[model samples]
Target: MSTVSRAPKRSLASRLPVVHQLQQSVGLQRGMLIAGLVVSGVFVLTAIFAPLIAPFGFAQRRDDAGIFGAQQPPSAEHLFGTTVGGYDVLSRVLWGAQTALFVIVVSVILSIFAGVLLGLVSGYFGGWLDRVLVVVCDAIYAFPSLLLAIVMSIVISGGQSSLVGGVFAAAISITVVFIPQYFRVIRAETVRIKAEAYVESAKVIGASSNRIMFRHVLRNATRTLPLIVTLNSSEAILTLAGLGFLGFGIEPTAAAEWGYDLNRALSDVTSGIWWTALYPGLAIVLVVLGITLVGESLNDLADPRLRGRRAVAQSAGVVAETSVVPGGSLTAGPGGLGGLEDGESFDEHGIETR
Candidate 1:
């Protein structure tokens, strides 16, 4: 019996990381998750194949005398249209996915590294260091997200023509905004988890603080980070767009960026050049929506109450019977209501009769 019980426990421990236990936990949320995966997968593929699938180079212009002139409407020659800058809108849109994915990946990675490090230290050691870090994080968190991004943009790029600088500026700014959220979540969990018996046992066994903090505490505390990461990736795209809209985006000649295109298209609306803005805007909206749906579904998956409800719903066909054991406390049994002893009597109804 002991070996059998330990076998199940070991299997459960092995499966936690490898299996997505929450994938089928709920119907509506799982559907949203599937939809998000489909949308995100398409964008990811677009990013990977931007160079090959895009009909034109990101900044390719049509100086050749043909139907592919500057600002031409969508046609066979220019599938989406030609932009005011003579670039192919379809190619630019496709390439923009690559740019967006890069920014999101870089920002989220940097933020997670910094945030998790600070969170682990602050949470494990509750001294003046923790207080100072907490105060600083809160102060930064108070600033409006876009405003903070703008400040970081100017600091990093000086509104310069460097493509790499603009990308880093946007990524770092998003990182700053995201770090505090990760820090707070991780810190709280670490504080609670550090007091558990296993953690105490590690301390008692002469484990170094560093080992226990990293090996034990950090692992358990960061369980929710996947959800945060998905949500933050979506925000990073928006922040990158805002930076571009304000003219702090990547240089147009160096890369195709959705936000920069939208900025250039601001005046085109008056002249009825809707294609320039519409496609990029839709790209941003759909990507963000897809990411948000994935994040929300992940949140639902992480919730215990939802999981319990889902388990109950799944087992609805199996009736659970409450019975009184010999000790007189009510307990569950496979058979129907079982409070009766050997001599107990019942009428046509299930009620007991003296």
Candidate 2:
């Protein structure tokens, strides 16, 4: 008796959507996905462990010796040099990551929940509510996102910037802009799915409207959400940065923010002090690039028209299945299966007709 070895089952984590995509991707797709993940992962880890990784507190201006002299160049003591305010540039960057992460979580969560729910309701029940929502979303879309965010931040915080208040200001503002995007995507999907045969069947079986909507429609409608989520996360980061850069962001004492750092570093750039702006600017660029790459790769892979799969090589031992005979014609002697009619097919043995 011959024994066959069974392949090991993937763990739940490996079967996760992004992980599964990574595993299934080949060649250039795989490379892009992996690179994005690595960059994103480092940012997340830096945020999580900022307290430990950073050499000093975000607001620390002095060590055991004395106050770090303002605009100090990179030295053995301070790696990335000191900011114009005498803050350690490296520590500020690390803590800024945490602040950025918090904003991203807050914005994406609120937007997804509010947007998805509204979309489902609006799409399933096409009435005055749907039209009203569509119009509202279109109006919101008319404004530039950063401009809207700035207006919202002023309205929410009244020009006062603190840790919690500033973070929420940025989050809520970004959420408002993103809700329309999610709503439109989900609503369109729901409208299409509600007319599917299975949905009609469910209705015919006397299923409750809520059950039909949630049990059948909502789950299928959300398959496209992850791509949007990734893209929006990146957008949220940019919006937060914009808010801070525009002088409506968190204070240095309350929390570190890359945008605020850049704002503070503006004068430094003119004075030929490169260190203050370079690192924080790079942090923003890299995090955004990582997220954008992930979103774009997944978007391409999900669309059949754009997805590129590696070509498979044929092995000499594995003969391909084909309908063609050696002579390129199926005519056998005087009578044979002539390219098979609708009612005829060859049997498994490759001889008898069935």
Per-model CA lDDT versus the true structure:
0.84, 0.88
RMSD of 1: 6.1
RMSD of each: 6.1, 8.3
Put down candidate 2 lDDT per residue, 1-354, tens digits, no spaces: 999999999999898999878866777878888888899999999999999999999999998999998999999999999998889999999999999999999999999999999999999999999999999998998889999998888898786667888788888888999999989998999999999999999999999999998899999999988899888988988888888898877889889999999999999999999999999999999999998889988887797654535323233223354336665644343225463534455555665464
Worst 10 residues of 1 by lDDT: 332-341
Query: How many residue pairs clash per model?
Result: 0, 0
Give the CA lDDT, 0 to 100, for residue 13 in model 1. Answer: 50
Number of the top TM-score candidate: 2
Q: Candidate 2 vs. truth: CA RMSD?
A: 8.3
The segments of candidate 2 whose C-alpha lies over 4 angstroms from its true place after superposition are 1-13, 305-308, 311-354
